[model samples]
Target: MNRIEFMTELAALLQDVPVEERREAMQYYNDYFDDAGDENEEQVISELGSPAKVAATIKADLGSQAGDYAEYSENGYTDSRFDQKEMPAGRAYQRKEEKEPPKTSRALKIVLIIAIILVGAPVLIPLGVGITLAVLGCVIALFCAFIALVVASVAVAIVGIVVFGVGIATLIPELAVGLALVGTGLILTVLGVIATVASVKLCLVVFPGICRGIVWICRRPFQGKAVA
Candidate 1:
């Protein structure tokens, strides 16, 4: 949607927010869209995703920032402290505590870890093992195919050489058959070599991508923040 529609939707969603805070958020986004210019309006909307998402993110951020305010009434003296806007929604926020290692009771942590392991062991372990085995199976199959192609290529070339040699060593009667065998072996050798080369190239291209995909999948669970 255009900037006007986007802003209107955002304002509607933020109606429950404090008037001043809502105005501040609207103004912030308005200025952002203004700076982006008409040419970049679509790009901005796409980048920000839906207005509803931005509003929700803002409320979530506000709630987390106002966690301490939970104990106090809305009219408390500390209300102004929570009135301050958090960092904008589209970017990552890192608290100082999040940067440092968290402290936890050793026994509790152990118990929690064990509990998670036990709960997920039946599913996660098998899924992980299955994925690994599948990948390994693919690699092994490719490797074996490559080996077979290379060996076949070498065997065909050897046959061609031997047949050609025999043709040259012998006289007229066996010469034609020997020459035909040599030709057939040479064609087989060429086809085998092509197959081997193609297989090697495919393995080289495909396995690295598979490895990177697996690494990305593995890292997602550990990452605390995700792009909206």
Candidate 2:
């Protein structure tokens, strides 16, 4: 075939390649033809063989070169030359279509997917929503309960201090009872303080865990990773 026919066939064969790569391939062959001159065109085409064969050879070369580059990178040596080169252009990069899917099979696959989604939506959607709501409600309830414990502890401590102060201001005739009141108030104050500290510690530990558990449950259906 003539140069035009040969180049057209080569371009068709290289359609799966990136635009720039195809262009580079075409440029190389065009240069080869020009260097050979008009009289040598036939000889050069014969040397290159069929366009399909030439495209395959180019693909093989690129694959090997890429593997070598990867190996070099793994060995901690980057290839600066590869980084510096400009890309060639043609059609966008795409995986080679080995064979087109059967039209009937493709259509059937789409219909099947749609049908499955429609049939399952009523059950799956409600179930998912219910689970999410339940998890949120539980987390909120636990948080509120912890907050209540802290509030109650503080109130009890305050009442204990007020009783102790009243006892201290009483007359000498009631001094023994006043000392007893002081002891009772001290015990209440200590218990309240302990309760407050314990609740705070519980919140610090349990709140995050609950939050994480809720997050993990919510993401489970979407195939998302759980937090550590």
Candidate 3:
């Protein structure tokens, strides 16, 4: 049969189903044919089989889902054969469509949130401020500590250089003391150079990571608020 003949028969057969379900099923099939196009109409029709078969499948599915209930026609013909295995694939019949939340529920939720904000403003505001201040304080303290480490390393290196210079000046005056001083200076200078390099490398890794973490933390509250 052609699409028109098949769909017409299907609609008549589904008269016992609820109006909404019937309409959805008809719309689904109508859209299916349109999507298949005129060239593939015969193939689509053959795959779907007869309209009576389709209607039976729909009734069986709906009956099973409706739970031990019977659907009757105007002539009092009742259909009670509800086998779950008889359910149709790729059909809108008996499908559970997602429904949006009602306007009243949405409005109530918004009102409840506003009420909570208003009631808790005094305590919440101060608590939020304190938490923000604590975070900022910790970050600042950590940054200062790192800076101090870098500065201390540089300072040690400078001190080692100065001692080395003094040792060179004293070499001619006191050979033994000068040799000891020079050795001490060399060790100190090497230690200072290692410390400086380690401190700089650590800062390079830590600074960017800390900055990114701060940015993420700062954006979190705003992102949640915006989504709500």
Candidate 4:
């Protein structure tokens, strides 16, 4: 986006916001692109990502939930199980007043870890098999590289004789071609060796990425925050 278009879009957004808040938000956004002067509005917009996304993030940062005092009771003990019981008027208090552990504390972390190991261990077995296959592919690449090295060495020896009669410049092209092929073969060999090594340690190296990908794909259908 050019500067003009970026300013135009920002102007549109500011129309929906209160006057005081609008000025503050625009100044914050203007400073974001001060260093990128004379760039097209499209480029500037792309760099900033979506305007709505940025605004939402800023709004969330500025708006914090106040502490809830009514969710607790004057009594020290909190009955988390939520069984209904009549309480005296003076006993009821806000939950924020209770200085207690977070819902995701040490015990919950342990339980989640144990549950995942128990459930996911079975799923990881197939991933272990895939890594084994990748290792075999690497072995094949190494053998091909070994063959290229041998052929390249033989070619170099013959070119030495050819250079004597053909002159140094004439042999240079042939030497360059041979070297290029050898270099390509060596690079492939290295890649194959790395893949093999990675496969052997699939659980540590490959499984996490695969799991994250799957989770991301599965989550695509459910987005957008609930208004309530």
- Top candidate, metric TM-score: 3
Q: Please report, in order, the local distance difference test score of every candidate based on alpha carbons.
A: 0.67, 0.70, 0.76, 0.51
RMSD of each: 19.9, 18.8, 12.1, 27.4
Please estimate how well model 1 matches the true structure, expressed as its whole-model Cα lDDT: 0.67
Clashing pairs in 1: none
lDDT of 2: 0.70
| CA error at residue 192 for candidate 3, angstroms | 1.5
**Which stretches in model 2 have alpha-carbon errors above 4 Å?**
1-107, 171-173, 224-228
Candidate 3 per-residue C-alpha lDDT over 1-228 given as tens digits, one digit per residue, 9 for 90 to 100? 898999999999999998977877677678667656777778777767789987886777576574454443442323344223342223323334469776677788999999999999999999989998998899899889988998888888888888888888889999888888788788888888889999989989998998999899889999999999
Tens digits of per-residue lDDT for model 4, 52-161: 55554344433452122212223221222112232121222232344776567788899999999989888887886787577657656755665565555545444544
lDDT of 1 by residue, 41-65 (tens): 7877877778888787667646867
Q: Which residue pairs show collisions in model 2?
A: 19-89, 19-90, 20-88, 20-89, 20-90
User: Which residue pairs in candidate 3 have backbone atoms (N, alpha carbon, C) closer than 3 angstroms, thus clashing?
Assistant: none
Better of 1 and 4 by TM-score: 1
- lDDT string for model 2 (1-228, tens) is 988999999999889887866677677667656656677677667666778876775665457575543222222212222233231211122434469765677788999999999999999999979987887798889889999999998878887887777777753669888888887787788888888898889899999888788777767867743333
The positional error of residue 109 in candidate 1, measured at the CA in angstroms, is: 14
Question: Residue 143 of model 1: what lDDT?
Answer: 70
TM-score list, all predictions: 0.39, 0.49, 0.55, 0.24
